[model samples]
Target: MIKPVKGFSRLSKKEKIEWLAGTYLKDQPDDVETLKQYWNEDTRLQQLHDEFTENTLSNFYLPFGLAPNFRINDRLFAVPMTIEESSVIAAASKAAKFWLDRGGFKATVINTVKKGQVHFTYKGDKKKLQNYFDKIKPVLLESVKPITANMEKRGGGVLSIDLRDKTDELENYYQLHCRFDTKDSMGANFINSCLEKFADVFEAEAQRYEEFTAEEANLEIIMSILSNYVPECLVRAEVSCPVSELSEDTEMSGEEFAEKFLQAIKIAEIEPYRAVTHNKGIMNGIDAVVLATGNDFRAVEAGIHAYASKDGKYSSLTHASIENGEFKFWLEIPLALGTVGGLTSLHPLVKLALDILQKPSAIELMKIVAVAGLAQNFAAVRSLITTGIQQGHMKMHLMNILNQHKATKEEKAKIVDFFQHNTVTHSSVVEQLEKMRKG
Candidate 1:
């Protein structure tokens, strides 16, 4: 039986790896070398990767790819994506190319509002606290002027602040709910800085008010932070064409293909199980772009999933329809993205990705990100209704299977070409590789 180890974190990297190998990889002599093999070749680059998060492990690599020919709002952009899963970039590029001549994607930023909250407890009187809030609203705004001045010069800052009574949810729980226009940055820091300042101002001003009783004057601050649920920060991306233009590119008519595609989306709409996976497929594209641009993909993902369930039940994020001989597919998602702050300018790859995108503003990035999701879902649905998802997905996954089996370079090339026409499966690839070895 394995026993617990002490002072593990105090050990050097080499020592830590040595202990781990002795304890866990006793049967596999070469596993330690395999782990070390993935370390970055450049010492400086490795240092940067180590500092990205805690515990300085070797870098884990994901393929960073470019999906080109994306025409959004008459401007072409080559979107960058970083993800481990294959076929996503291929599918997105295919959809972009498919729609390149058919008006491509159209995206609009409906709102750029972000949310933050300052929670506190005031126990004496609701009306009195309300009156106190009314009197100090302007002071609250003025207190954050120092923080907001720079953001204001850049055309972004706090938009509104309101006192929210949530005593019904919990005893004496009142909040100073606020909204902001973050402009071109994912203004978590900016919003949070302002909120913390607001809390300080509210507390100090309440102490100065003569109408406030001793109990009401001493408001206990629970917390102040920005919210990840920004339903108002919305962007809509859509593609439309005549139903007759939708075809299987083989023999199926356009109308028939459109019907099948709409049915696939409809099934995802009402079915919770399917909708979850369906929305995840869309996120595959959205997250890839979000990471490449150095924004918070996890927050965007949480807010989007919450929006998906806003109508009482989780459903599809992308929708499709045929109206008046037109086939339209679209997605409206809340994405709080930044093009100027966080890792955008600090990370090298993020800088390159943003520059490659022509350094769009926050709203422009929102539209582009939304288009990525829409395009990804359309490609997935197109595959689902026509050739089936496995055919393309397995084909893309074939090389990964080959690599896992330790196929030689020459063997990989030959097998890749062979699988182009033939079926691709784990067992099938293994059999083919074995046959080639014999030959």
Candidate 2:
């Protein structure tokens, strides 16, 4: 069994790695060296990465790739994606090129509202609480002025505050529901600061209110935090073309493929199992961009999945339809992204990724991110309704398997040619590679 060590963080880098390798990694020399190899050669850069979070270790790297020829809102963009999964960028690129001449993609920002709350308990007259809230609303807003000053100048700050009665569901429970315009930020820290201040003012003012009974004045503040469920901070992205365009290179006729595509989407929409994986396909694109751009991918995932189940049952995030001889596919998702803060300014790759994207504002990035998802879903659905998914995914995954076997450049070239007409499966690729190796 493993045991904790004192001042683990104070240990020198070499000693830390030595201890970790000795304890958990069996002290494997090559594995320990491999971990050391990933450290940045520049000590300053390594220190920056080390200070990013608590524990200090070698860098964990993911491939940062680009999907070219994305045309959104009449502008061309080569979107950057950072993810470990294979086939995501390839699928997104293929879809982007597919829609390049078919009016490209269209995206619109629906809204940019964010939220936070202060949870408290009051076991007094609800009528008195309401009147007290009405009286202290301005005071609560004013209490957070110092916290909101900078954000307010950025055209983002506290928008509204309300006291919500929730005693019906949980006895004596109420919430200080607050909303904000965070503009270009994810705004967790800002909103959270404001909420804490709101809680402070709320409880303090209650004590001073002449009409408040002793019980009412002693309300207990449970917690104050920003919500990741941002339904109002939404963006919609779409692609459409005449039905004839849907047949571009597929075997099925345009009309047949369009109807099949719609049917597939319908199944995902009304079915939970399919919708879960279906939405995951969309996130494969969205999360990559969110990660690459230094925004919070986990928060984006939580909010989006919450939105997926907004109507009760979790369903597809992307929608497809055929109307008036045209096939349309689109996705509307809530994404709270920031372009100027967090890792966006600190991480080297994140800065470069934003620059590669032409330094879009938060709104523009929202549209690009959503378009990436819509494009990804379009490619996934197109393959599913026609050739099936594994054909392309496994093909893209061939090189990963080859790398595992340490295939030489020459061997990889031959394997690539062999799979052009042949189906790709692990066993089949293994057999062929073995045969090639013997020869």
Candidate 3:
């Protein structure tokens, strides 16, 4: 049995690797070499990556690709995407080129308000608590002025603060709900710092409020943190053209395609089962951009899914409609992204990705990210409505299948040619490769 190791973090990089290899990978010498193979040759660069997180280990890598010809808001972009999945970039690029002549994509930032909360338990008189809260609201805002000053100079800062009573749900539970405009930063650390200060000041002020009795004045501070769910921080991206314009390259006419597409989206909007996977495809586009740009994809993912279920039932984030002889496809999604802090200035690849994007501000980044998602959904639905999804997807997945079976270069070329006119399945690819080798 393996025993727990102490001071693992104190171990040097070499020592850590040795310990891991000896303890866990005892019989796997090749796996040990594989771990060291991925390390950066530049010592400084490798050190920087090592410092990114605890337990310094070899770096994991994903392909950083670009889907070009994305014309958003009259400007063109080769949106950077860092994902390992095959065909995501291809699908996005296909969709972008399809819309390039059809007025491209239009995106707008709806709002940019983020939120945080200070949860506390106060078993005091409800009326007196309300009175005291009213008296201290300004004080709560005033206490965080020093922290918000720099954010304010950038035209982003604390918006408002309100005390919410939730005693009915849990005994004596209450929250100091706060709103903020973080501008060009994701502002997780900033919002969290301000929230902690607010909690400190609120707790300190409660003791001084004479209107509150002993029980009311002693508010137990629970936790103070920023919320990932920012419904108001939204952006809308859309593509629209005459119904006849959607007929390019597909077997179905524009009108038939539009009707089928609309029906598909409507099903996603109403059915949770389909909506989950439907939205996941959208995230395949959104998350790639989010990760490539060094923003928090997990936070963005959480906020977006919450917004999808905002009406109490999880549904599609993308919607479509054909109105007035025109077909429109669009989505309004909440994305809190930043281009000024965190990994934006840290990671080398992240900086390059931002530079490729023309170094957009938070709002511009939001618009671009939303458009990626919209374009991705358009490609997916378009494929689903005509020629089926696998025709394109399995084609993109062909190389992966070939590589998995260790096909040589010449074998890969011949096999790829054969599949162009034949359906691609794992068994079929293996069978063809075996037949060729036998010959």
Candidate 4:
């Protein structure tokens, strides 16, 4: 049996990999070489990657691709995406090219407010707590001025602070709910720093208040952190054209395709089972761009899903309708993105991705990200309504299947050509490969 490791983090990168390989990959001795193969040849660049997180073993890579012909707000762009999935980039690209002729996508930033909270417990009189909050609110704002000064100068800073009582939900529970505008950066650290300061000052003031008893004055701070559910930091992206224009290449009439597409969206909106997968398809596009830009895709995912269920039911993020001979599709999602901080400045590829996007502001990034999602959904639904999803998805996945079988160059060409006129399935590809090898 393998024993637990101690001081694993203190181990050098080489030693850490040796220990991991010996402890877990003993049967596959060649795995050590496999890990080393992925390391950057340049020592300086490899060291930069190692410092990004703890227990640096080796780099795990995902393909960084570009989907071209995305015309958002009348500006053309070749949006960058980083993901491992096969068909996502293809779907997004196809949708972008299709819409490019129909005036492309229109996007808008609805708002950019973020939130944080300081939770504490105090068995104090409600009226006294409210009065104390009102009195100290100004002082609380004043205390964080040094931290917010730079953000303020950039036209972003603390927006407001309010005291919330949760005594009925949990005894002795209260919180300081705060809002902020961090401008170009995601501002997680900035918001969290300001929140911790607020907590310190709030606790200090409670102790000195004359109205509070000793127990009430001793407010216990649970935590101070920024919230990932930023419902107010939202953006909207949309595309619309006459129903007649939607049938450019499809076999169905534009009106028929529009009706079918609307019904598919209606199913997603009303059925939780379909909505989960439907929204996942949208995120396939959203997350690829979010990761490429080096912003927090996980945070964006959490906030967007919460927003989807804001009305108390998980539903579709993208909406579609056929309105008076016009076919419209759009999505409004909460995205707390940054163009100036975290990995955006540090990661080389992230910087490249930003440049590819024309170095947009935070709001601009939100709109672009939202449009990517809407475009992805449009492509997916279009496929589902006409040719069915698997015809395109399986075709895109054919290359991955070929690689897995370790087909040679000549064999890959033959197999790819064959699949163009034939169905693509794992068993069928293996059977075809086996036949080709035997001959």
Each model's C-alpha lDDT? 0.92, 0.92, 0.94, 0.94
lDDT of model number 1:
0.92
The per-residue C-alpha lDDT of model 3 at residue 186 equals: 98
Q: Residues 1-439, candidate 4, lDDT per residue (tens digit)?
A: 8789999989999899889888999899899999999999999989999999989889999999999999999999999999999899999999999999899999999899999999999886889889889998999999999999999999999999999998889988989999999999999999999999999999999999898899878989999999999988989999999999988779999889899899999999999999999999999999999999999999999999999999999999999888789889999999999999899988999999999999999999999999999999999999999988988999899889989989999999999999999988889999999999999
The TM-score-based order of candidates, best leading, equals: 4, 3, 2, 1
lDDT of 2 by residue, 247-283 (tens): 8788988998988899999999999999999999999
Model 3 pairs in collision: none
Candidate 1 TM-score, true structure as reference: 0.93
Clash count per candidate:
0, 0, 0, 0
TM-score of model number 3 = 0.99
Give the TM-score (vs. native) of candidate 2.
Answer: 0.97
Q: Which has the higher lDDT value, candidate number 2 or candidate number 3? A: 3
lDDT of 2: 0.92
Score candidate 4 by TM-score against the native: 0.99
lDDT by residue (1-439, candidate 1, tens digit) is 9999998877877888888888999999788888789997888877777677665556677788999999999999999999999899999999999999999999999999999999999889889998999999999999999999999998889999999999899999999999999888899999999999999989988898999888889998999999999999999999999988888473679989888889989999999999999999999999999999999999999999999999999999999999999999999999999998788877789999999999899899999999999999999988887788999999999989999999999999999999889978899999999999999
Q: Of 2 and 4, which scores higher on TM-score?
A: 4
